[model samples]
Target: MKINNKDEYIIIVGCGRLGSHLASLLSKERKSVVVIDNNEKSFNRLSKNFSGFTIEADAIEEETLLKAKIDKADVIVTTTNDDNTNVMVAQIAKSIYKVPKVIARLFDPSRQEIYEELDIDTICPTILSAIEFKNIIIEAGGED
Candidate 1:
């Protein structure tokens, strides 16, 4: 659990579409990253695409976080499909270990406000999806 001062360490939980994309982009920026995903197969997509540490485990567990060196992390980003798990992991990382920054992915748009109120930055994929949907509808509608 060593954090190198030269680069900020970022922990990304979940290796699904969003997580994988974010991890790849961050790794491209040359940031030290440790990604945790329960499904071993989830990491397959990330293997060649990402140049960072990958851990196959639950991010909700403190021990898992410790193993990933959450205590030393500059930021913890929970991007799992499960909102509860992401929120819980964010809370633990923020409240317990007191990480300077915690970002939790919100699958449900309904919870975005609440997460923000709690001082956890939430990235709602639904919002982005809706915007994309709107653009597609507008483009197709114009052709008709």
Candidate 2:
């Protein structure tokens, strides 16, 4: 399929494990992808697999987002380790940039509802990881 401005450009914040995997997958699918992170060390995840642009900066910063052209981005995915930062990034994407979609990775389950109230999509990796671990344990007959 042909992608254009109406197709929604994807901007992924945080270049850690999940962020890297997500960026590579999205880019591979022929979607416009931009990855950002505060620390340069996190970008190693995109070193080889990512075919998109990567920026080293804070996603919550308006300057950084502007530099990444967040105003034109159709979607924003904030996968930072900090829940507050993720929420702020999503808010800016939605309220400021008016991006159509924003997804945030939340570290604390307690703030999941708060994020939703703010109109930001939030994913709790801790809960998902725990569920996956339980499933694996069950599959392995509860063995270590």
Taking the tens digit of each residue's C-alpha lDDT, what string does model 1 give over 18-103? Answer: 88887888888789889999998998777475789999988777789999998899988898889999999999998899998888
- Candidate achieving the largest TM-score: 1
User: Quick one: best lDDT, which candidate?
Assistant: 1
Question: In candidate 1, residue 20 scores what lDDT?
Answer: 86
In angstroms, give how far residue 26 of model 1 lies from its true place: 0.9
Error of model 2, residue 75, in angstroms: 1.1
* Tens-digit per-residue lDDT, 83-103, candidate 2: 788888889899888988888
lDDT of each: 0.86, 0.83
Report lDDT (Cα) of residue 46, candidate 1: 71
Alpha-carbon RMSD of each model: 4.4, 4.1
